[model samples]
Target chain A: MRLAILGIGPVCALGSGIQSLRTGLQGKVRPNIEEKIIPTSHGEKMLPVYQPVAEGLDRFIPKRALRRVDPFTQIALLSTYLAIEDAGIAFNDKSRVGVVFGSGYGPTRTTFKFLDNIIDDGDIGASPTHFANSVHNAPASQVSIFLGLTGPCSTITCFEHTLSNVLVTAWDWLNQDVVDYVLVGLGDEYCDVLGFAAVGMNAGRTKDMQPMNFNACTFLPGEGHITFLIAKDKSHQEGYAKISEIRMRRDLEEVKASISNDPVIINASGNLQQGKSFLKVQQKQLKSYSNLYGGFPTSSAFDLAVGCVSMKDRKIYPVPESQKKEVKLENSIICLEFCREDEFNIYKLE
Target chain B: MSLELDLKKLIIEELKIEDVEPEDIGDEDALFGEGLGLDSLDAVELVVILKKHYKIDLEDMEKARAAFASIKALAAYIRENSEVQ
Candidate 1:
């Protein structure tokens, strides 16, 4: 199942919308890496993290409406609003538009707050709002409730597999004619626990990421939400890119053999090609924007966003100005995201 | 702070009733619908707030409807309940 990306709504360290994304990808603007202090088992530790917290949410949704909503749900709502605005469609029937959201972590801060309520005042003193927002599907529920979207909605929490699952799910839903359009979302948040863990994990301050060197875990924790409004027909708005095929393979040779020709490897192969000499020796134009958007498990959504934008702009924007490459319209971009030594997902876009 | 004022702040802060300041809520204004526009979720939060801050454990809102009628009423109810408890 394939769907055309009608609109892109991404909120990250680089900023919101495709313009900000394109600017950051072109290396025109640099996202400042801020320091966050988190209390861990070994006391508190300060670490570098990317806090792309959703801003000015009151502009889209009423402030009162967001009273019980947590930060995780707030970003999901904001990104959904952005995707809808980017599409610029006057829907005849909003109930037919389905929503699918994916996340690496769902409201860890809220969950911990609920736990605090339990600790401070015991089990009976737990807060109702905190308890309600602590679930993994709370964001998706909030989005549908606030927007009054009556269509089929779901949330997937699969860590690194979140982005691919979200896209593939939306693709299937649209192709199966279950809905006219599918609004897909992928997000991960940086809370206090994740912050100290990233610090203890030795997330280095390497300003750039070496895509080929998988051993160097120089990824700082980042938080953001990237959404796409996709449909079978893109006559409503200008499309960013069309998803042709998405495949998930658990074998190294199978994944490698699938992309034997010149493929636009979106991000690093990581553990997907263990001992695969062809992938290591192949002369491919590897591009990674990890410097712009920091590192989270589902950052590949940002990669896909960049790929779609690159295809739209007819130029691939590398992190530094030196790695600039012009992309042709006819070239098919294969975004390879690896999960484990023998597990990977491929997204082919033109 | 007066019990009325403190309850108003809790209602706004914990109940998350936005665009309205503590002083904006009148002493005689209703805490639920039409007066302050609080809903069932806000009712649940108010119950927790009472339990957490006032040490007044409410088993349910069925018996507290009159006390929650207004901020003044709620304050008087709390004072009366504090003495009894």
Candidate 2:
């Protein structure tokens, strides 16, 4: 809590970098949902997936340099470059900055590719490159190498709670004086295996996500990465918002009882009958960006990234299209990410 | 395809080597460090490629290095061991 967010970077289906998010909030961009063939238990299945355009990545890492790198690593690397470039800090002593990445599923595409090789060709045919990139911390390792960060580097995975843990870890590193700034981020790429599983698992699904409709699983698999460059010191000229507090609770009654008319973003994208308690926060004029990025387990990170954009741009992006409520330009925003009725995290930004 | 040309294609595809074509690589050019600039990872990938394509097992690391010196050397090694020729 109380960490200053110097810069925020987001790469999603809409596109890469913060300007893409600004255009997305302005409703000027749409993602090209790519279809791929995946063999399921029944037969071969073609499913739609949200893939990032990654247009700005070439400016940071040339395409030839990234040919050997997996897509998952490419996504994370782009996010890091965007955050650093947005922060506008020319870091001479990179050892003072650390890296921490969270993920719902680490390198699913590369891991599956490795397994595919093992299945098609014997173990002898397995490519060593795929095996090396399949690990959980590979992205973080690659980030440290590219950024030349001698500070502590690590990765964490806990499904929906991954973002909360990542932020807390960043704050802890700053508090402990282990580093001056922390490059904290979360990402999960959508592959054919996950796409097939998502279609099979959710019977009440749709092509678009309705995050406000807590009664339905109108969800689709989305892919991308989001990063925040955080520092304990706010010496920089501008910052997104200060993380005032992070509270984990089992109920929203207190939050609703103390809630104001100010805008609050509800991370309510999930299956029906579960996470319905998030509907209790309707007392506040709400905003949700799940439609722009689609639905994923670590969507809370995406929500926070949207919150940062809203904080910086002084505008609340519309969801549900009707836009019944208008949030005052300047005010504190609270982000509520609900995993269940009893398990959720509340982030206060001011 | 000829064995030498096939090995060249395999090197480019399996190693994810970009911006280089089969014709660009000389028949007797070095495959690692000074020539194509492939390192140990590429060497390991080349091993898997050889084993998968020709069923030729270069268990001896030195012999693998010798064969990997050039696409022509790799093709000759395959011809000496593999029955396709």
- The model with the greatest DockQ is 2
User: DockQ, per-model, please?
Assistant: 0.67, 0.71
Docking class for model 1 is medium
lDDT of 2 at A11: 84
What would the per-residue lDDT of candidate 1 be over residues A1-350, giving only the tens digit for each residue? 45789888888887776677878876777665687776767776667667674666778888877888988888878888888888786556778888899988888889988998889877667888899899988888888887788889999999878888888888788778888988898888878778777666665435444445555555567788888888885545478788887887545566556664534554452222422432553446555566667677778888888888877877655544456565454566777776765567778787
List model 1 lDDT by residue over B1-85, tens digit each: 7778888888888877778999999999987889999877777677778778877777755757877889988888789776422
Worst 10 residues of 1 chain A by lDDT: A269-278
Tell how far residue A309 is off in model 1, in angstroms: 0.3
* Candidate 2 residue lDDT tens string, A140-209: 8988987778999999998878888888899999998888889998999887778777778662246566
**What root-mean-square deviation over C-alphas does model 1 reach?**
3.5
* Model 2 misplaced regions, further than 4 Å: A42-46, A203-205, A233-236, A273-275, A282-284, A323-327, B82-85
